[model samples]
Target: IALECILLLILQQIAAPGPQESADDSPGIALAWKAHQIIRSRFHLPLSTAVLAKELHCNADYLGRVYRRTFRLTLTEAIHRQRVLAAEKLLISNSLSLTEVARQCGFSDTSYFRQIFRKHTGLTPAGWKQRYCKEHINS
Candidate 1:
């Protein structure tokens, strides 16, 4: 009985949301969280909204609506943000080139990738990396 109780407690902790996160965040927030999990689960693979929708058991349009409404950003924007954030981490800690980072982050075109990075971050990828490294070194 004690072992079962301990297992249940552990499971509960694993499933529980953060203390600062409220249960009433929104339907979109819930959908975004689910989407985030699905993306992370298949991070190594090429993925799309159609694929994600199938995995999530929802229509692509509905998923997009929920995602945008909940997060105040389009699904594409959300996905790009995740990809860029991953790229940022790699840029800071790894020796991968910009093209390599773009490829690894799901951007097939190097030029388009640079444009998107600049659009989102207001800095070229190289500039972002330089500033990031400088900040870290100073800190």
Candidate 2:
């Protein structure tokens, strides 16, 4: 339920027009939005800018540039963010080990998963889980 709410919020943010963007969306904005949807749906898979661009029938560089410009983040960062969000929910709601959580969240290696998780959340997966559980249990 928490994960669903977060996903919905992210989608809403992506769909909302930015201050500089007009009501009539540009082609790049449209493409970026499509990319965002694809990232959300297929986040559990091995995703890359090349793979996404191929699926979206656009050039990889163009897609990367448009996605970065539209969202102010790189495509790889977006994918990592989605995976980390899902990982956070799994960490709290399941008894899965860190390796299992990393695999299930589309991270190819546990160490890499830890690195990215800490980058985003400022804590290791286990640390984040422990802190979160402690905080919620006391509430």
Candidate 3:
């Protein structure tokens, strides 16, 4: 009986995430990880805070608060960052025009896409393309 109890305690300790932790414990790190998964999987779609909250099984306000705290940026800002990074890559491809790049990155308006791109990069889409082209030629 003593050996059985000892073995059970050892197994439980080994299975736990940390000291004083319960098996059902959900930490901020876990929540942040789930949030990242949800964003990556659904980011290209037109999604609202309510929709993301529902998908994550949290309140919109709470989700936004925790997400911003965890990522140091608001949910909308994070999505925009992702979209603009994608747009920058697309701009380099030379196969797709700015309109197509905007559409592919889930931007509903080309003008809005250009605006956001410029806001994040300090350069408009055309300027970014031109700078990259100039750098390549100089190299």
Please tell me which predicted candidate would have the highest lDDT against the true structure.
2
Q: What's model 1's overall lDDT?
A: 0.74
Question: 2 or 3: which has the higher TM-score?
Answer: 2
Q: If both were scored by lDDT, which would come out higher, candidate 1 or candidate 3?
A: 3
* Full-model lDDT, candidate 2: 0.91
Q: In order, what is each prediction's RMSD in angstroms?
A: 8.3, 3.3, 11.4
Candidate 3 structure, TM-score to reference: 0.75
Pairs with backbone N, CA or C atoms under 3 Å apart (clashes), candidate 3 = none
lDDT, model 3: 0.75
Tens digits of per-residue lDDT for model 2 on 23-119?
7657887899899889988898999999999999999999998888778889999999999999999999999989999999999899999999999
Residue 26 deviation, candidate 1, in Å? 8.0
lDDT of 3 by residue, 1-139 (tens): 5985795467445434566655444454356457655665666677666777788787888777766655566778877887888888889886798899998887989999999999999999999988998999678
Q: What RMSD does model 3 have?
A: 11.4
TM-score versus the correct structure, for each prediction? 0.70, 0.84, 0.75
In candidate 2, which residue pairs get closer than 3 Å at backbone N, Cα or C atoms, i.e. clash? none
Q: Whole-model Cα lDDT per candidate?
A: 0.74, 0.91, 0.75
Superposed model 1: Cα runs more than 4 Å off:
1-32, 40-44
Q: Rank by lDDT, descending?
A: 2, 3, 1
